[model samples]
Target chain A: MSDRMGEFDLIARYFTRPAKRAVLGVGDDCALLQPAPGMQMAISSDMLVEGRHFFAGVTPFTLGHKALAVNLSDLAACGATPTAFTLALALPRVDEAWLQGFSSGLWALADAHGCELIGGDTTQGPLNICITVFGEVPRGQALLRSGAQADDDIYISGTPGDARLALDALRGTLALPTELLAQARARLEQPSPRVALGQALRGIATAAIDISDGLAGDLGHVLEASGVGARIDPEIATNLIAGCAHAAAAAGLFPYEKLLEYVFAGGDDYELAFTAPPAARQAVDAASRKSQTQVTRIGSIEKAPGLRLVDAQGRSVTQTFQSFDHFA
Target chain B: MSDRMGEFDLIARYFTRPAKRAVLGVGDDCALLQPAPGMQMAISSDMLVEGRHFFAGVTPFTLGHKALAVNLSDLAACGATPTAFTLALALPRVDEAWLQGFSSGLWALADAHGCELIGGDTTQGPLNICITVFGEVPRGQALLRSGAQADDDIYISGTPGDARLALDALRGTLALPTELLAQARARLEQPSPRVALGQALRGIATAAIDISDGLAGDLGHVLEASGVGARIDPEIATNLIAGCAHAAAAAGLFPYEKLLEYVFAGGDDYELAFTAPPAARQAVDAASRKSQTQVTRIGSIEKAPGLRLVDAQGRSVTQTFQSFDHFA
Candidate 1:
């Protein structure tokens, strides 16, 4: 900490780069960006705290990746193309090695999406990372949570519960094989934002949301906004946990009850949950193939008022699950 | 904290509002904003940490105002018109009174500029406030630090150093009269960002920057970016502290040396320091009058390589001042 560079030098060394998409970049009072004509800017902000958001001993590289990934996930939900972002970070003290790893991970993800690093502030305090990301979408074409309608087919991109399984293992509440634990841990740490899939779903999906606070909770947001309900097939949802379906059933390792809970209420999975009319199923499939991401149809939107879990015969299944809440 | 509202309830009650300037406001994955055609969006972010930027027990109202005010000052420096902003806040615990007071203060200032609150994240952690503000400037019309030229007259808007004086008084390092202390403390807690003045100077001033890290250091940024130096008149600069001129000279309240130090090295003064060619002095005066903010000419940009303090006779005077640094 004592040997670390000053604030300006630290910013210049790690974050400063030539502007490719922005009219003005770092080192100015404000970064200037020109949104393309006929485009609307989509903006979102996310904050990651040391203990609340991540474990105390988590590596800086993954922390960096997850911080920006969460915000980018919001853009993905809006069907926007990545543009630029600003990072405001508070550190307990300056650590060059940590900074190097953090910035490397940040730039890797940013470069993959052609998102420019713009202007932000860095200060000394408890470790906190806040990123505000900007993206552009064609006017009136942004996928919104309020756009869902009855009879729409509900779909989710990628798996959603592996992160929670990993967290359970790390908490010593569950036992897992070493390789399985490693694979699940990566899901917990390095969330990949489905930017391309989001863009591909622009005209197809009626509504979308990023699954961060568990499937049940985040899906609730879309339902509430769209004034609709959903009926999810429990069998399909339970199988949405990658690699766990075969391993758990074949080895008779984890209980079915725990797997169900993880599937519904496992938070921190940066995947996309979207809804589209049944008529657009082929188009949705094409979008999935275009983005090279798998899509799973696990539910259907309904005119009812609450979420329901049903069996293959459409019989309601009673289950109690608690979604993640920051205040709670 | 245990009895507080849930995260979604808290946000819906306090932060959610109807969109006026933004295409979409709170309660969305991402807020949509449409900049008027041919306008460039100017963006900036600033983070404030408790125990570093503010005292442990500072009032929530002032903290809220100062947090957004500082970021608005950045837009002011760029000569942009405020549009919208996002706030990502971390709190140690939930307090209804704190939330009410903070949100009231935040909305009061935000409404003054017609800036809408878009989208952000809230979580449980050590207290921190990070705001990313957006504004718009006509293309190629932003006031930048790199636009200064030799012989440009440097000006200061409003008064500087009163906030620092109040801070010193609070620290018990200085003694000020009761009434004077109250006035200065208000300046420290509730700064008025010169938004109108910045917009007024858009086509007049060559370069501009807000005095955050003290006048000397922030001015250094303009000078470095413009590849120019400056000569400041200490006598004029020292008198820029509000209400201190007659009080200090007549009553001998504070030392001249300390006053000078505060004038140049005092941070947290959300005032604008700008430069304009001498030929535009009348236009500058008109801008100052139009914005209802006072402006004073205290220095002149030069072709030399460093800042120099000069007496009335134009002879160099030796003085050293250390600007505030987060890690220092």
Candidate 2:
């Protein structure tokens, strides 16, 4: 890769490989893709700027991987199979080592999901990475946030909040045991996109969203879009942040209940939060089993206008949750 | 569309609209598009950073217009039909006025091109705008730089160097009469994309590229890709600068010859540079007539290995052109 070389040279060296899966790839005025017959193209974009989205001294490899991963997460939420992506990058200066690591990290995830780097623009500016990913789903079968029904059960794939816990640990607001810290840090840096699970659950999933700005906030989007409310089980929700007590103990919390905040409100988990009809529970379980991803039914959609937290016995709880807001 | 408001609310208020063309639109995990049958999807991305790409005093409306325009220029170069786009914006704060103007400018051009705002991400950070545009072309019909051949006529659309002259004027490096300055400034802030001309040129223009980093540098890309050289006519190239003679006179140049630099090396022209076989001259003229855009033949492709500048006579001219370099 020509990271430290001239900008066009860098693109030629790294981003300009021949278009294999793509109808046309890098080096043209634009890249071309051919979606499968009778399919809809799913498109999503995400931007990450240095010092805001990432800490100083973070490796470029992690930055590249996370940049594309975030956009892919949106595709996974829509149950689309990854196809292609374009990157627009602004670099402070050409650093060969950084570019090599970054491109390696980027291509690893892209190749794993069969996503091709189609076209991109690289320029001289402050460090920023923006990626737009494209995927495809069968017409009328793709999942969406507005399709949830009042009686549908809300489920999340894999785990949530570990990335937030890692953020908290890095910020020194919380202390974590070695094992937990390592696990959380990994999640923070390289959270997996639930693409296989999302595709597998397509028709079975009534509505879907990737848990990003915390379960409380992101689910709020589902509620807003689907015109439905939700009542989440706090007991099961707390289990989502299992083993975080070790971190709370390390921090010497008096009530030891602060761990619950991460459970309900921590963002960046990159997990899939979907709703499925109760009658389709077997199908949902089967899809999750096929993808080898753990599916947790943590709540039920309701006709009410807002979200709620309930005790295991179904009594209302008085806990407030916060969503991660870029502005707030 | 959301320039200054709270991110999600801003999106809901301004960008969340029903997709008349897209299968899915805003408020979902991803927006979905279905290319017409037997068509390939053409995709391109561009990133514009505040200060690096534009002056601070420029309006959000102009910023919005230019961001999309540059990407559309790529579509024009590829002879792709404008279809859809995604915008990822980073802003410092929510300013209702700015968002309104920006969205207004953005939509004006979008509607004119029939391009839909598909999906995007908005976040808090240093001000930056990244857009990825999608288009469509019949399979195997895309105009590529690599398709240019020896003996092809090299052509450009509209004007070049006016934007660079505007840039120099903004930097106080040149002076111009008010009328001249205003015209140049319009070219800088709101250069039009030759979308129709591009679509019409398909199957006629052998190869094409958009003049972005200056004719000299951008044409270098086409030449490098096509493995051919060029001999540009100085008389015709000089006329491409149009009314810049007043600025050169104001700058106290002997016989006002400095205008040539702006013609050859000035960047941000956003015009098309294309190649066509001499035999297709009649068809090229018909395409230009159909698109109602001016097309100029400025040079000829050659079997030689480097670009050469020629006088009104056939002999070569000893001259130099400077490209806009971000790092330099």
Candidate 3:
């Protein structure tokens, strides 16, 4: 005989809670939500798979955090306020310990953002976590990738390559000191979603996108949508990598060329890349200070048709970096 | 070199389309939805896995239809008007033919309901389809499981046991004629969510739930939520099975007892189970005619604490049935 709990029991133990902001919550056929008057709803979904998104033996706690964080990142990119989310999970078995840790980590981030888990589904299958998040933004104030204009100064929030550095170190393709590896691993595992900064950037940043599939690739999306090109200062772009300022003094540091690749095409970095008019530079600084997140200017939107990597003196910098694609 | 399509190309070819109703659609970080003024959004998520939810060799078209249909069924249960949905899919490999069939089937149902495909994520992994659907209902008009009252009449939309019959036949446990099997298979595959019927019953029905986990189990949910019991006429309940009316005259028909079991405990029946005050029976009939969906009354809600199957003369009929549970 075995004492395995049923699906309903598992959900009641770990997932079910009283509705806070949602009109209706778990146990209902559909959760009900009423956004404030005249507010538009923003929706985004992300799926995380074992072995493809993370290592097989990774901790469930961080896995839960990362699953919801990637989705919240999209809301942040849209300059929307976090509201609610639904999680559809497929698990191979019912391990109570794993469930306890996973739900704990999930609630920690959810509570911080005031995003409630309204409703979801769980079934026995291969491990997959798909989260669809709902947020709210005032009409016409939400940021979009198609809003960039020529002469807008491009910017990035936080270090964008630290997660990739940690990934490479763990994958054994590169090496890092134990202390630095710990710092980078945290970036890979529990990267913060800049919800406050995104809200602060409303009406200020011309366009924005979260760096998930590398800075260069995601920025390419913004460029294509806005029908504008960008001239990124390679020197400044490479300087956005974590530990880049101390690279010369640090032993076992990778070369600047490799650092450029990490910054340009490293995936899993949940930082924002955005653009604003030069006249709004002070306003952007105020937003950055208000949200307590660092912002770095790295380039400018141009009327040209393609991305150009340039030096401090505007000399062409020759390089090629492929963005991460799941099926390429 | 191989000529496999990348994820973006696949999405553009098969998934991406113009934003018909959404403020922003595919290709953006998130889709924007503006529900009609004075409407509350109803949301639900469902996940289907290959081999567990469907046979490995099942047609991709039907898989697509079933995935979205099941999620829509939740909206229907809540008396919400279908608005849009996000699809999160993971495929083992890129199969052009499969993608063509799947997206076609998806759009066929989506177009019928005017539910646009808003935003989603696709990745490489074990095949899993997770869809989160959104719908709108006027405030205070949503049908909920907790609204059933004592002496309310219980009703079910359409037949409930045909899908289970088809499943049993496909599993080789039951025998069915070629033509009859095809009829049942369609019921098992592409279930028509009672969206119109749900809306028609908005003010008439007191409590509602879509029969996903068998008629007995789902009704149990309603009973538990409303703190009421139900007394179902065994004869009337068995008559709910498809072809049950012709069962006595037909050869190759299963016993009446088995039919009762099927109607009572069979799962995957997306038809709705609902209740209304006995005084509103005529109004319920008018709704049934308006929605063009048949409704059958088989029982009455009572203040008692448990379900009881009774004969036409009100004598108790002894039987036991367990509902399907994914992890039980």
- Superior candidate under DockQ, 1 versus 2: 1
Model 3 over residues B213-252: C-alpha lDDT tens digits? Answer: 8999999999999999999998877765444222421454
Best by DockQ: 1
Name the candidate, 1 or 3, with the larger DockQ value. Answer: 1
**lDDT (Cα, tens digit) per residue for candidate 1, span B57-135:** 9888888889899999999999999999999999888899999989999999998988889989889999999999999
| Separate DockQ for every predicted complex | 0.86, 0.65, 0.82
Ranking by TM-score: 1, 3, 2
What does candidate 3's lDDT look like per residue over A1-328, in tens digits? 1237887888788999898999999998999999999899999999999999988888889988988899999999999999999999999988888888899889999998999999999999999999999999999889999999999999998888888888988899876777878888998999899888999999999999999999999999999999999999988776654442225214547677777777888789899999999999999999999999989999999999788999989699888878778789
TM-score of each: 0.98, 0.95, 0.98
User: Which whole-number lDDT from 0 to 100 does residue A185 have in model 1?
Assistant: 89
Query: lDDT values of the candidates?
Result: 0.89, 0.85, 0.89
How large a fraction of the reference contact set does each model reproduce? 0.86, 0.73, 0.84
